[model samples]
Target: MAAEIRTFTCLTDNFGYLIHDPATKATASVDAPEAGPIIRALEREGWTLTDILITHHHGDHVGGVAELKQRYGCRVVAPHDKSTKIANVDLRVVNADVIKVGSLLARVVETPGHTLDHVSYVFDAEKVVFAADTLFSIGCGRVFEGNYPMMWDSLLKLRALPDDFRLYCGHEYTASNVKFALTVEPDNPALKARAEEVARLRAENKPTVPTLLGDEKKANVFLRADEPSVAARLHMKGADPAQIFGELRERKNKS
Candidate 1:
């Protein structure tokens, strides 16, 4: 029942994860933005990659698939919709598909806001979710191929997860996200406190990921779009929650 989650930085602000289960000596790599760094992480961890769990077809998310598969001979599991782009995809799974890695079971959640094919892997046993780009520490992914309402629906699915679930997103943009969040929810006390904390963490050169779901519910504008406080701050009365979330997301992009 032993497990470890390792985070690696890649390509400016992208994050890649290496998840290992010690009970069966099995490992899974999530959204490897690059091959070399993931390889280095695997070697340093003394874990052999048994599977590669991809969330989408974006280059940053699937760029290392070809090389890693050739090198580790690991099964590449990705969303069924993007099988064409993922190299040597051995298992094409859809929403709710459950895959096993040692004692850990990963349940696939179809979170298609960042992209129509985007997915999130939920490790239910550990109460954590590899949220790719759909959900971030203080922000959410840009609506690349989806609309405001659609993205809102996608986020709603994630909001139901346990409040304690640790969310490991696909990028390192917490510091920047907090800045924009302040502009949108300037009066939010929780957001103000979080912005200060993020500043300190960045100043110290520390990681700001693996943020809890509860904190996001309080500080992330996307999650708070429905709160009267958030809607009031946006200067729109009785605004559609999804529209508010989308506007906040747009602001973050240009932040």
Candidate 2:
């Protein structure tokens, strides 16, 4: 009676997740970066495509919607703000909206920064989040649609979630991101242990996502803006937390 979530790497780095509810043999794809892998997974699991959830309008995230929708005639769900760009959306949802995958419920979290129309789905009942590009494993998405302050605000909202919440980010860039993190906190023991573990995982070409929020808070500098050590490293000069986060984002963009 166990529900399973299967992830397939699409494009070069993007991830496409399929949450399978065995009880109903229903599946939902978090983002459709590509159709080939997703189509294959559906066949492999003998699951019906119940829904397609889009986090943002980015091409890498929604490029396969039309094809997949036509293939399975699945219901498409997207953020209400980007309904215009999301083709054939069945339900335009807003923040706090709850949707179901069989019996499990997932709440929509309006997290904008990487994109103004961005949203992340939080499966609070399962302690899992489909964070898209808002919050990565060790690094966040580069600011493209919003500024430092907006991104900082968005990140703060996510940081406030329960420590045990597991983050399922959009990309498989943990190894490189960990390398950049070391430049910011070279002496952090947590970062050191995680880096070694990430190296081993990447060496075997394994995915390094779905990290716990508490672990990211300790090792990821972007999630550590409130800490004195990160503040000093970013040379906040006694500025507020928002200002410090802004500075670090700018530095990373240039780094």
Candidate 3:
């Protein structure tokens, strides 16, 4: 049977995910944003936490790791690169590493950009990706630790994934991200439709997590940096994809 994944809110805007494999009764928390919410979710689901898969070392991301580890005694799986400290790690993984959660297998994808040690977990068997910080529903993480080119390259790695993959990103910034995308490609029908849809979703105070990669490619401006039309929109025809991405990210930062 396929892995059962749950998404819930954490902190102010961050998201929390729990991936459970029923066959072996193995459950893994994608990240420990906060111990309270995670504990509540576990109690609600009646699933015991067996592992914690960390994507990055940001405060919000790892804030509850220690508490959760103490409370549940769950194994903590973190990235190999330790530019930032993440305590209580049982396994340190790198790109191409395969992590097993029960019968479920997740391929570690090193997508450093928002942070040099950042990583994404791809559950290829389930066609789902937990892209914390590095990628978002309608946007991407800011280039805080890596250069523009490095960030762009990291994004490319995600973009290379199959379009059918379901992307479970870090935060709930789709509303603002979609608004910013309109200014970049105002005439894009897909983007325009997405903006309207996002507006309705937000108006109802709904979560827009688990967006499809295919739809994101068609609507997300940042993902289209390599598209000639996107470059032309900024009067930057023939510019390198990395340069276009940098310009788009800069504009988004200011927006």
Candidate 4:
């Protein structure tokens, strides 16, 4: 059976994920944004957290790690880079590493851009990816520690995943991402439709996540830098995809 995932809001806009394997009754939290909510969620589900996975060392992502580890005695798994600065990591993982969560498996994919040590976990059997801050529903993370080319490459790595794969990102930024994406491809019908859908979801206080990769390919301007329509809209028909992606990132930063 596939792992069951539960998502809850953490902090201001961050999201915390709890993934449980029913067969083995093992559970894991993707990031520890806050301890109170995550502890409450685990208690509500009657699941004991066996592992805590860290994508990067950002404070919001690891703020509650120590507390959660103390409370649940969970193993901490994080990136292998020395620069990450995360504490109490029992296991250090790099690109292509496979992590075992009971009977389920999560393959790590290095997705640097948001941070040089950023990594995403792909559960092939479940067709789901916990992308953290690297790839959001309609927008990618800012190039805070890496360059535009690095960010573009990271997005492409995610874009190359199976179209049926569902993406679970770190934040609830879809509504704003939709608005910014429109400035790059205003005439894109798919984007326009997605904007409407996002608006409706937000109005109802619903999550707009676990979105299909196929939908993102159609509507996310950041991932469509190579598309003719996007290129034409940016007036860079023959420009390299990375260059177009850089310009779009810059525009989004200003927006």
Candidate 5:
């Protein structure tokens, strides 16, 4: 059976996602941004938390793990690098690890950019990915712990996924990301249209996430560094894609 996904705002712009598989009555929280919202979400849905999946050790992502574990006895799964720092981690995973949440399965893909230990989860059967901070709607995470080359390779791993996959990132930064993206590729029709749509959504206080990978491939400047048009627009035509990506990341940092 297909998983049922519920997304809600947590701690300002962070998003918390709950995936439930009715077949096995298994429920998983993608990230515990905070305890109140997650606990409330579980109560409202009448679903018991069977698992808590951590994308990284960022406080905003794992801050509520202890509380949730105490409340639901949920098993905590996190990346191996910083698993020790995250409280109550029952399973430490690495790249290519497959985790089972009852009848649902998620494939872990280590993506080191925002943090060297960051990982994204992909549910192949559902064509959905919990990308956390690695890849966003119109932007990618800042290269804090890793270099541009590392971030670029990590992004390529995600960009290579099936175009139809749906991406659920860590934050609601699409409005700002689109603004920065326009500065990089102003003449891109797809981006311009998406910006307008994002503006409309934000105007109505709507969430602008769970964006389609196909749409991102066309509009996200960070993901388009390998495209000739994006490179040419930056006056870096014929430059290596990784170099273009590095320059873009540098510019975004100052933006």
Candidate 6:
């Protein structure tokens, strides 16, 4: 049988996700922004939480972990980086680690940038990627704990995923991301089309998570630093991709 995934809003702009594997009757929360909504989702699905897979130590992402774990006695999986300082960890994982939530399997990919301890989870069989702060639908996270080149490398790692993978980010920043993206690639037809789509989704007070990786690659300017047109638009022709990426990130920070 197929696993079920549920997504809901939490803590203002944060997103909370629950994935349940019916075969083993196991359920895991991608990140816990808060407890109420996650509990509600579990109640609605009638699935018991067995694990909490943390992408990073950010408060908004981990705020509900302790409460939920105490309530369910769920196992908490976290990053291998000790500097992240996440408490209540049952297992600490690094890149290429295989984590199990009953019969469901997730591969870890270290994607430090926003934070050196940040990680992304990929359920390849399910074709889903929980990238958290590393990547967004039309943008990427600001490089806070790591340098621009490190962040660029992290973005490249995600961009290398299969184009068909579904991307689940940490927030609802699509509309604003699209607006900033336009200034970078004003003439991109794909971006222009996606802007209209994002506008409609936001107008209805809907969430725009779980977008296709392929769509993001085409429309997300942050992933297009290597594109000649993008470089030309930024007036940085024939530049190193990392340098171009750095420039784009600097502009986004200011935008």
Residues 1-255, candidate 1: write the lDDT tens digits: 557999878878899799999889899999778899999999998989999999988898888889999998998888988534777899988999999987789999999878888899999889899988888888889898878888888888888898999999999988888888888878788889888888888898878888889888889888888888777887866988988887787777777
RMSD of 2: 1.3
Q: Candidate 4: where are CA atoms >4 Å away?
A: none
Off by over 4 Å in 2: none
Error of 4 at 204 (Å): 0.6
TM-score of every prediction relative to native? 0.96, 0.96, 0.98, 0.98, 0.98, 0.98
**Model 6: ten consecutive residues of lowest lDDT:** 80-89
Query: How does candidate 5 fare on TM-score?
Result: 0.98
Worst 10 residues of 4 by lDDT: 80-89
Error of 1 at 254 (Å): 3.5
**Which model is ahead, 2 or 3, in terms of lDDT?**
3
lDDT of 4 by residue, 145-239 (tens): 99989999999999999999999999999999999998888888989999999999999999999899999999999999998888888899999
Question: Comparing 1 and 6 by TM-score, which wins?
Answer: 6
lDDT of 5 by residue, 73-106 (tens): 9999999985347899999999999999989999
lDDT of 3 by residue, 59-86 (tens): 8999999999999899999999766789
Candidate 3 TM-score, C-alpha based = 0.98
- Which is better, 2 or 6, measured by lDDT? 6
Please state the error at residue 20 of candidate 3 in Å: 0.5
lDDT by residue (206-231, candidate 6, tens digit) is 89888999999999999988999988
Q: Evaluate all candidate structures by whole-model CA lDDT and list the values in order.
A: 0.87, 0.87, 0.92, 0.93, 0.93, 0.92
Q: Whose TM-score is higher: candidate 1's or candidate 4's?
A: 4
CA lDDT of 114 in candidate 5? 89
Global Cα lDDT for candidate 6: 0.92
Considering summed lDDT, which 10 consecutive residues are worst modelled in model 1?
Answer: 79-88
Native-structure RMSD, model 1: 1.3
Off by over 4 Å in 5: none
RMSD in Å for all candidates: 1.3, 1.3, 0.8, 0.8, 1.0, 0.9
Candidate 6 TM-score over all chains jointly: 0.98
For all candidates, the clash counts are 0, 0, 0, 0, 0, 0
